[model samples]
Target: MPNQSTNGPSGRPKPECDPIKDEKMGLMREVGGQAVWSLSSCKPGFGVDQLRDNCLETYWQSDGPQPHLVNIQFRRKTTIQDVCIYADYKLDESYTPNRISVRAGNHFHDLQEVELMDLSEPNGWVVIPLKDSNDSPIRAFLIQIAVLSNHQNGRDTHIRQIKVHSPVQNSIVSVLDFPINFTTVQMAQHSTIR
Candidate 1:
C-alpha cells in the first residue's frame, strides 16, 4: 500500500480545510435567490444582478459613499449558515473590501450586528459563518452585508459574487411508499445489508 500518512501520496502535508465549510459549499443548498437582494448604491449595469450572476468577470460596484450595503430580505424566517463573497485583491486593488459587517433581524429597522470581520488581502471566495458562538445557524428575515471600508481607503467597492447557503435537510425516507404499505415489523424483517 502507498503511504497512508497525513502527507498522503505527494509527501507534502495536505492543506487543512474546515469540513463544515466544505459541507456548506458541497452538501448545502444555495438559498440566496429566495430572498430579495438590494444594494445601498450601485453603478449602472453593475448591480445586484451582476453580484449574483455566478460569474467572476462581472461585479457589483458601489457608487455612493462609504459603508456600502447589500441587503437580503426573506418573506419568511430563513436559516442561514454562512455567506460567501468572491473578491480579487489583485484585480480590484483599492476597491477590494477590507472590513465587513454582518447583521440580521426581522427587518431593517431592528437589525442587530452579528459579526464583524477584517480581511487583509483576499483573492478568492471568502466564507463568513453566520453561526453564533454556540454554533447555531442564524435565523432571520433579513441579512445584511455592510462593507465598512475598502483596501487603500477606496470609496467604492467591487464584489464579484455573493452566496447564501443553508444546510441540506435530509428528506424523510419511508418504507411504506410501496403499494403494499410495509409495517414496522415487516420492514425490520425485510431489511438487508447491501
Candidate 2:
C-alpha cells in the first residue's frame, strides 16, 4: 500500500505545463455546424479533414516546400464576405505565413489576387476581410500563401482554422420547393460530386 495526501497521491507536486503549447492548441471556441474549409492537398495526417474538424488543438500542415497553395472549392458558389483565420502565431511564428494573397473566381484560370495580407500578429483568431470587388462579394475563393515567415525551428506551415463567412442572402424558401429529380445512386453513376 502507498501513502496518499490531499495535494497529490504521494504529496508530490504536479509537473508544470508549457503555457505556449497549451495556448497554441485547443484555443478557439465557436459552436456551430462542421467547418466548411475544403482544400486539395496537405500532409497525410494533416489533411483537409482536420482543417474543419471542430478542434483547434489539431491543424492542417502543408506538405513539401515553399509556394504551397490551398485550393478551396465550396459545394456551391458562395458569396464570401470575409474569412476568420485561427493560427497560433506565438507558438510557430517562423512557419506562419507573413504574406497571403486572396484569389477568387469560378475557375482556376480566372484566379487573381483580390486581396493581400501582410500578417504580423499571432496566437489567436484574425479575421481577414475578403476584398469586395466593385462593391460585390466574392463568389468563390482560394488562399495563396505568397510568403512564408521562415521559422528557424520549423519548416512546415501550420493553419489551425480557416472559416468562411457567407452571409445568408435570404431564408425565405417556398414551401413548394421540391427536391432534385436525380437520386444519390444516379448522381454517383454520373460523377463523384461528394
Candidate 3:
C-alpha cells in the first residue's frame, strides 16, 4: 500500500516493466506442469493493461499437488533502499488463503493469513518487504504463489500483474561493503599435517 517509488539522482522516473498483456507475463512466467494463462484467453473487449481484472485463469487440476514459480526482471535505476511486491488474485468461500513465498537472493520469506474480501471485485493484494541484511544482493526476485485445496474439484485462480517499485539507481557501487570469508583459503592455511 505504501508508495515504493523514489527519485533518482537525475530526477528521471525509474524504468518500470509492468506486464501489458498476458503475453508479456509469459516472459516472466513459471508454472507447475501444464497450467497456464494469458490475456488473449480473456473475454473480448477487456483491456490488457497493468490492472487487477486483466489476467485469465487456465486449467485446474484436482490430482497431483504442485507449486509454480513466477519471475520478472526490471531495471533498478536508483539505490532502491527498499522495495515491496504486490499481487492480486480471486478467491471464493471454499478457497483457503494460500501461502505466498518471496525470495530475494538467498533470503526467503512467507506471507500468510490472506483472505478474500469481495467476490464481485478482485481480492485484495499482499505486500512483502524485500530488504533483509542477510538477503543476497537482489538483481531480481522470484515469487511462488500457491494454494492448497482439499475439495474434490480443483478451481483455477486468476492472477493480475505483479508490480515492483523502488527508488532509482545513480551509481554502480557495491550495496554492501564487507569482506567475504573464503573457506578454501582458511582450510589451506590452517591445515594440520597428520
Candidate 4:
C-alpha cells in the first residue's frame, strides 16, 4: 500500500514512465541467499534465550578455560537500539556475573560493553542498548560470552532473536513501490479473481 517513487531529472513523471510499473518489474527479479544466518533455534551458548524469557542465570568469562562466541552479521548498515543475550543457569548455581565482549568492523579492537540490564519478567528478555559513545556503525558484529570457572558446565546459554530498526539507508534492491488508483481500478475490474 506504500507509494515509493524515485526522483527523475524533471519533477514530473517522464514520458512513457510509470514509477509503480518499474518497481513491480524490478521486484520480479530474484535476489537469493543474501542472509548469512537465520536465527532459528536457541543453541547452548549464543546468549539469546535469557532475554527472550527474562532470566539472567547465564554469564560470560574471558580468563576461563573455555570461551563461547556468537557470530552475527547484518547485510547492511542498521540502527540497532536493543540486543538480547540468553543463557540458562541450569548447569551452575553460582551468582557470579559473566563478562560480555562485543566487536565491530574488525578484530583490531573491541567495543566495551556499554549497558547491561536484567530482564524484568521471570522469563523475559535481557535488553542491551547500543548507546556507547565509542559505538561505531556496524554491519557485522560478534559477541563473546564466557562463563567463569565457578559457572562453567553449569549454565547453558542460548541466543534466540535479535530485533533492530530499519537503517536510514535501507537496501535499494529491496525497496517496493505501489501503483496509483488508475491501475488499481483497472486490475480490480478486469483481472482474474482467484
| Top candidate, metric TM-score | 1
Per-residue lDDT over 1-194 for candidate 1, one digit per residue giving the tens place of the 0 to 100 score: 11122232376644543433665567877889899999999999999999988788999999999889999999999999888888899999999999888898999899988877777677777777787557789899999999999999999999999988887787887755545545799675676445
**On lDDT, who's better, 3 or 4?**
4
List model 2 lDDT by residue over 1-194, tens digit each: 11121123365543433323433464322221322444445788897677677578888787766655666665566666555666777866766765556677766787777666555545566555555647555566343333334345355677877665554455589634645456688564644333
Q: Rank the candidates by TM-score, best first.
A: 1, 2, 4, 3
In angstroms, what RMSD does candidate 2 have relative to the true structure? 17.6
State the weakest 10-residue window (summed lDDT) of model 3.
Answer: 113-122
lDDT per residue (tens digit) for residues 63-172 in model 3: 22433333332322122222222323333323222443433331124322211111222234333334434552233332223332222233433334444434333456
Model 4 segments more than 4 A misplaced: 1-35, 38-65, 88-97, 106-122, 134-156, 159-194
Q: Candidate 3 overall Cα lDDT vs. reference?
A: 0.32
Assess candidate 4 and give its lDDT. Answer: 0.34
In model 3, the Cα lDDT at residue 175 comes to 24
In model 1, residue pairs whose N, Cα or C atoms come closer than 3 Å (at least 3 residues apart or on different chains), thus clashing, are none
Model 2 TM-score, all chains together: 0.61
Q: Rate the local accuracy (lDDT) of all candidates.
A: 0.83, 0.56, 0.32, 0.34
Better of 1 and 2 by TM-score: 1
Q: Using lDDT as the measure, what is the rank order of every candidate, best first?
A: 1, 2, 4, 3
Q: What lDDT, from 0 to 1, does candidate 2 have?
A: 0.56
Q: Decide which is better by lDDT, 2 or 4.
A: 2
lDDT of prediction 1: 0.83
- Model 4 root-mean-square deviation: 16.5
